[model samples]
Target: MKRRFLVAFLLLFFSYSLNIYAVEEEPSPPPNIGFSLNLLGPIFGIYSLGVSSFLTSRVQLGLNGTYFDTRSVDPKVTGWQTQVRMNYFFSPLYKSGFYIGIFGGFESVQIKNNSGRSDNYTDPIGGIIPGYRWSMTKKLDMLLGVMIGYMYGDIQISPELSFVYLL
Candidate 1:
């Protein structure tokens, strides 16, 4: 009777311990997607937002839309532009989060005079936007960068500062 009681107690204890271990397993978190709002200075200003997802470990593809406004010292030389861009980022497989990439896309610009006269133009613009992004937490980041390129029959170089929130 003593031997049978001991075996039964041991089995119950082991089963209880296994159950507790199973219940303590943690669930994995969802993958992170990034978004940003950029301010590109006085002569020209742009606001852009995008989402990126990794296809491979080091390679990501993203789509971005930008609303751009530009004005010369003369109000008669004001223009509005819009663009859709596709981007690719290359870094080490494990270090994909910190790196730079080249972006290219289509842009349309409309320039108007306060006199109510308007001119419209469309073109392909490509440039390098070099910047560093640091993850503040799982859902917030700080982005600082600059973009230099050509558009609308002139060369463009703009400095940008932005705060990004990931959802």
Candidate 2:
């Protein structure tokens, strides 16, 4: 009976020690808040800014806003957009690795023609985005993704490229 008890105690102690070591080996949790800017927005005549927060170790929620004017390109388009999103990261922590998300938003656009006539419209938009976020430095990350969904009764696909600063 004593031999059995000794063996059981040793096994339990070994298991507990392993658990403690495993916990110590884990990476530190990421920051809770991040600010993001769209890198391609300026080139396309759109300016955007966003904020995101970690809801859980693998989940994050974000809000973004954008304003655009394309008079230089053609169609003389001007618009503003706002969106909110929730993402589930496949990585062990937030703002890293592969992620899939859903977003819903609204946009208002105006187009002016050469004849000086203008058309204005507003629409609600929703989509699914798949992306990857990589660390650029200790506190910066770059995200690359695509949004696919419905807008103005039509299917739309848009590319996304952004940089995030974690705090």
Candidate 3:
């Protein structure tokens, strides 16, 4: 009986030691930086530039800027916007593909009337924007999204699309 107990204790101790010494997997490295730019139309032109850094293989943090110009009417309207995003890649790293994310940012709008009309109002605007991104390559990408919030006392909704290139 004593021999059996001694053998059992030795077995249990060996198993416990093995469990403690088992190898663990290392964490994945972060994502590299990326950028994109976009043209809406002849009346509307937009530029978006950003950087994406991987927090993990699947997740990333991004900072971006958007510049918009509209020239449909006699007056030309322009806006400057900025955003920060968190992204998730659908596929593994080193694969050619795309990524999606949620973003929020600040925007400012200004309108100028080339006609020198009395109806023109020079004002500075502010708002919030949300959007998503798709990567065509490691250095180039496209994004589509919207902005809905308050600019001055008015509620505005602006939809935007852009392409970006990493440097």
State the C-alpha lDDT per candidate: 0.52, 0.74, 0.55
Per-residue lDDT over 73-142 for candidate 1, one digit per residue giving the tens place of the 0 to 100 score: 3333333444343333222222213334456777676767678777766877767655555556656656
Check candidate 1 and list the clashing pairs: none
Tens digits of per-residue lDDT, candidate 2, 38-130, equal 887788688999999877766779999988787676557798889998976555543246667789999887878788888876988899877
Segments of candidate 1 deviating more than 4 angstroms: 1-32, 39-45, 69-98, 112-119
Instruction: Residues 27-87, candidate 3: write the lDDT tens digits.
Output: 3553366554456444355556666677776576777776657666545657776777675
Error of 1 at 123 (Å): 0.6
Write out the backbone clash pairs for model 2.
none
Predicted structure 3: lDDT: 0.55
| Cα TM-score per model | 0.55, 0.73, 0.49
| Candidate 2 whole-model C-alpha lDDT, 0 to 1 | 0.74
Model 2: weakest 10-residue lDDT segment is 18-27
- Among all windows of 10 consecutive residues in model 1, the one with the lowest summed lDDT is 87-96
In model 3, where do residues sit more than 4 Å from their true spots?
1-30, 39-43, 73-76, 94-100, 110-167
lDDT (Cα, 0-100) at 63 in candidate 2: 98
